[model samples]
Target: MSSKVYTTESGEVVYAMVAEFETPADVYHAAEKVRDAGYSRWDVHTPFPIHGMEDAMGVKRTILPMVIGVVGLSCAGLGFLMQWWMSGVDYPLMTQGKPFATWQAFVPITFELGILFSAFTAIIGMLFFNRLPQWYHPLLKKDRFLRVSDDRFMICIEAGDANFDPDRTRALLEGAGGKHIDLVEE
Candidate 1:
């Protein structure tokens, strides 16, 4: 049979292929198969968390913690430098006969700066990494996808994946016991 392509009303483009599953276990195993098959641009949705889903999906650790650590350290260093320059080099203030550029005096501010910067970095990094503040998505247009918040589980393989072929992807979903397979359009 000839391969059929789905398009938007304006003939825009196909977004992804969405498949429904009845249980978390079904979706979890399906995710493993999709991952092992070397499809990178795919995701699973379920009503509740499933244990070991990350391993099944081959999801790697996020770099947010690394980013936060780096930013926190850098900010702390800057805070120390600012205090040193102001007290020792810039202002040259002599307080209570204590030597200027006193290391002890900078500890609190340095720690505070590190904590503050780390907290901010965590928030911003999370938003950036998650691609958040996205008010709209093509998947929201699929009525069946709304069931994901209820009892249904789903997997969506994006058309952007290099290995994505309409017929083969559909067949793969079918083989994985995915039902209500539909092509979403952008």
Candidate 2:
């Protein structure tokens, strides 16, 4: 296979090596190959979700759950503290001989704050972790990649991967039954 020389204006860099596959099954198997080859910074894109794709790609569990848990508890604690300081310390109020600092009155607010913070944390955390607001991508410049949102499946091995080698990566993709393997630039 002839290596396609991709030239761009000064400072333009190769972003990734993309491979096109016809079906989800092909992409799934190709992902397994790429994973076994020990290449990190790779991704598979499909028109629709495929079961077991995460496992095939060797994706680890995310820590967003732990982050949300901590944020939720902290907000709940703050809610309780705020209520106690206001009713008990700042301004003492007694009605019907009831104590000024009542834990029961704080339950609803505390629970609500916990739920609210947790939900916000989940949204913000997911966006932060996924690196959202990406206005542009090198792959978007490829006309063939447009099929990715419709019927084609693709696997991209980023040039930043430690195991990445232009020739070897292209060969690997071809061996995995990938067609029209192209080098994307940034």
Candidate 3:
């Protein structure tokens, strides 16, 4: 078995049908309609995260929250362990002659570390899963695509997937009332 090698300067190009819409509402509706048609490898770009657009695209909520939960729990456990080892077992410091393993002192650090771990987990998981921190992408080269960061809403359907057929995808976008029909090439 061999893994495909892609050392090229660009990501594998995706063939897309481009559309230009006069309003954000148009692209939002187009996204919903396109999802209903069942092209799984598609994406929508907008100047902002439009309301209800995620549901329209059939995108499920991310699992990163669950990951954060687990991290938080682990952090709590570890924090307790650290306090136990340092104050109870290792050093056994008798502060004001108070009893060891007092909950009063442990509470703040435990809570702080738990929240810290969860935050770190959420951020790292989001970046890893989304393949972010990336410096470049071919689509960023498209002339009008920059509008997606501002006032434009656009959707893209990737080519080369198992279900992708260039002509058919183009027709579907057209029927969905999409405008422009541009391809992202390497």
Q: How many residue pairs clash in each candidate?
A: 0, 0, 9
Tens digits of lDDT, candidate 3, 9-118: 36654555456565778888898888888777678887777898889999999898888999899998899889978888888887798978787889899999999899
Residue 109 alpha-carbon offset, candidate 1, angstroms: 1.2
After best superposition, candidate 2 residue 147: deviation in angstroms?
A: 2.9
Poorest lDDT segment (10 consecutive residues) of candidate 1? 1-10
Clashing pairs in 3: 17-181, 18-180, 18-181, 18-182, 19-179, 19-180, 19-181, 20-179, 20-180
lDDT of each: 0.91, 0.90, 0.77
List pairs with backbone clashes in candidate 2.
Answer: none
Q: Is candidate 1 or candidate 3 better by lDDT?
A: 1
- How far residue 163's Cα lies from its native spot in candidate 1, in Å, is 2.2
lDDT of 1 by residue, 69-180 (tens): 9999999999999999988998998779999889999999999999999999999999999899898999988899998998999999988888788889999999999999
Best model number under lDDT: 1
Alpha-carbon runs more than 4 Å astray in model 1: 1-12, 47-49
